[model samples]
Target: MATQTYDVFQVIADPSRRQMLQLLSEDSLTINALASSFDMSRPAVSKHVKILHSAGFISIQDIGRERYCILNHDGFAEVQEWIDYFDAFWKSKLKKLEALLNEKTGSHKL
Candidate 1:
């Protein structure tokens, strides 16, 4: 049998990896550039990058001897799709809360 490959959930399991993605979402940065802002060492950041790379969350580009980390955000669709399943529940809860608040403050008239 062959091993199947998929790591959408594993990539987000680490807090550090999650933070790295959050930072990369705003803009692409070189490994050194990304590492400079954090208190952790470069090797540690590199390890996180390796994991992200394996998970297909980010890509690297070579530019004048420097490698830049680009956020490969296509993978996020799955995450959003998963979360949207609970949206209706949360929306209903918020609506109920709004109605209750309006009843108390006379602000819910609509």
Candidate 2:
């Protein structure tokens, strides 16, 4: 079977998946452990985990018999980059507005 691809944003769009990421953020946990925190069935939880894994938000490691899920930075990096671009964009706009306001108000101090 071909490997499934997921968009990082789409994968994180689901509330369940977002919660899973939040839980994993605290520390690594087994699939079962992650599932226990949610009201969904184990299989349902596993499905979200699979999406998270495929989207690069998490890494699953086999420790003996249990599979542990750990948070990964790869997926978040894309989100952060996007946010940073907008952040700079907004800052530039605000600076221009500030300069205009200062010019109108005769206030040279920035």
Best by TM-score: 2
- Candidate 2, residues 28-90, lDDT tens digits: the string is 999999999999999889888888998889999999999999999887687788899999999
Which pairs of residues have clashing backbones in candidate 2? none
Off by over 4 Å in 2: 1-4, 79-110
Per-model tally of clashing residue pairs: 0, 0
The sequence of per-residue lDDT tens digits that candidate 1 reaches over residues 1-110 is 33345487777887888899999999999999999877899988988888788678898899899999999976666878778977977999999999888787885455
TM-score for candidate 2: 0.65
* TM-score for each predicted model, relative to the true structure: 0.61, 0.65
Candidate 1 regions exceeding 4 Å error are 1-6, 77-110
